[model samples]
Target: MTMQVRGSKLAARLTASMAALALLGTGAVALAQNWSTTVVASDNGHKVGNPKAKTKLVEFMSYTCSHCADFAREGDAAIKLAYLPKGDVSYEIRHLLRDPFDLTAALLTQCGDPKKFMGNHNAIILSQEDWFEKGRKTTRAQQARWQFGSNGARRQAIASDLGFYELMENRGYTRAQLDKCLIDEAKANALAEASQADVEKYGLTGTPSFVMNGALLDGVHNWAALRPVLDKQR
Candidate 1:
């Protein structure tokens, strides 16, 4: 009977050790990965408030996503007011480009000065409703053509004709800068590849996702519901 009791204790210890090892393995993997922010020559990234506060809140977003726009309109202000201004939290916006056009916007957004990240972010979010509404009138096949087509020249022409090019131009990007950003095949491909790597690493399938520390906030339909989670992290 004593031998049996001793064996049981040994098994328990072994199981506990294995569990601890598993936890450590997960942390080691997460630590190995880097999550540096990407900025391109385009106007696709968005930031609403503080960038250097303590609790970093990184949001994954796409330009074409209505839900993303909703978060921009509703939750962004509250998050900025309650958390950002106090220096308790900092936020980073990352691109989740779905197609080649989305890539264009992403590239343009990142094209400017890194310090202008917030301005570029705010610009995209402010124009969200209008751009989305205009985009929806087109057929899905056309949208897909806009997004995934292999013909870079034609695709960019479509983006320009649709006023995406003009939109950034209005934002003070010179024609030369816009053309340079749009035609750089290497940079755009790299950005797309990096964004894809992030999606797979995070195991995410949708846009407008949030990562507050290690905890995930799946969506941002409303801010009142999200405060407690951020507060708890504080």
Candidate 2:
């Protein structure tokens, strides 16, 4: 009887060990999920989350728009944390360039590695005010430089004058690398052309528009309105 009792005790210990291992395996699987961190550059947009996700959320935003900035601050964190990790929802941000200043900033967002696009995009949009103030106070000389020069030169002028150089430098980009991206005429024209194409294709009339699962979400522009829709999606 004593030997049988000891065997039962050992079996209980072994069962507990297996349970703990199972729990650890579950945690490892969770940690291995890269849906949230995986970022990719699309045609004229930057996307994050599982490409195969059923619910595709596309945001048409402009760097120069305050409302777009507001959405970036309020909505991005939750979406990245909640929806993206589940691999059920994907978020893509498309630029709708409205002006030279907007196009200048958009070019900078596409600078450097494709993996860095999301961070660069968030940096520009969230810090829009800091640069907008500087843009407002720019000298006529600076404005002329932005408007009349070659595509790259004009954007380069905007970047220098609006404190964007300082902004991107904070993100660990050197001036030379950034200038190279700024001067890429092919990229500039592509982004601009894509922006116009999106405007017409989606009937986008303003900044901070939304398209979910191929249907444009009219009047659903801000976080408060969007959260409910996301919650109902899954």
Candidate 3:
């Protein structure tokens, strides 16, 4: 009798484990299916094109990436011409962990009025080549080797390279805010956590990637290639 009861309990435990696994798998599928182009943030966050447009496009970019800059300068013109002006699509840009300097630049961009978000985005993209000429490269591997390796040193370097740190000085953020943005333990943890979430959720592995109304588009292709799809959605 004792042996039979133990076997029954063991079978029940196995069944419970299998049920839990099934639920986990179902949750992951739901998350993937629900992956959205919209980033719900207070204060409008960083957006472009039409705010109330029917379609939503989200861009994952890094300020330090030349390819991303190319997309911003060359590709954006066509994007703006088509989706932005038509009130058919709303655009959003989010940052993934490309490098530490990218974080510093992001902090600077987010420092001022959220109204000028795109302005700051353009400023960084436009200056990409110039900054590279002056020996500031914003590549993923390069950033990891240099910036994340030493947060304090990288912060000071960016304070000199970009006026972002200084701009926030008068904004009532003590040294703590500046350092917190650069080395804030929580923010750093959050970036890492969010990055992993983005990767698994979106199957994204690089920058300059886009999701146009839930359609995933990756690469450096021109807007000519993008219009047909955008048009169909319209």
Candidate closest to the true structure, highest lDDT:
2
Q: lDDT per residue, candidate 2, 1-234, as tens digits?
A: 999999999999999999999999999998788698888898898889998999999999999889999999999998999899878999999999899888888889888787888889988898888888998999998899987868899989999999889889999999998999889999989999999999889999998999999999989989999999999998
Candidate lDDT scores, in order, read 0.67, 0.91, 0.64
Q: What overall lDDT, based on C-alpha atoms, would model 3 receive against the true structure?
A: 0.64
Per-residue lDDT over 1-234 for candidate 3, one digit per residue giving the tens place of the 0 to 100 score: 999999999999999999999999998876553112332332213776556678887777777777788778776766665556645677777776677667666765554456655655666667777666644544465445445547655765665455554445644445665665565555555655665676677888787777776667865244556567667887
lDDT of 1 by residue, 1-234 (tens): 999999999999999999999999999886553223322232224444444456777688887777777777777766656666545576667788887556766766666676555555567666867666666677766666665545466447655645677677777878777777677788777877778877887766887787776457765434555667788866
Q: What is candidate 2's TM-score against the reference?
A: 0.90
Per-prediction TM-score, please?
Answer: 0.67, 0.90, 0.62
Q: Residue 214 in model 3: shift from native, Å?
A: 2.5
Residue pairs that clash (backbone atoms under 3 angstroms), model 2 = none
- How far out, in Å, is residue 72 in model 3? 0.8
Off by over 4 Å in 1: 1-52, 136-155, 218-224
- Model 3: which ten-residue window has the lowest total lDDT? 35-44
Which ten residues in a row are the worst by lDDT in model 1? 35-44
lDDT of 1 at 99: 70
- In candidate 2, which residue ranges exceed 4 Å CA deviation? 1-20, 23-27, 31-34
Which 10-residue window in model 2 sums to the lowest lDDT?
A: 31-40
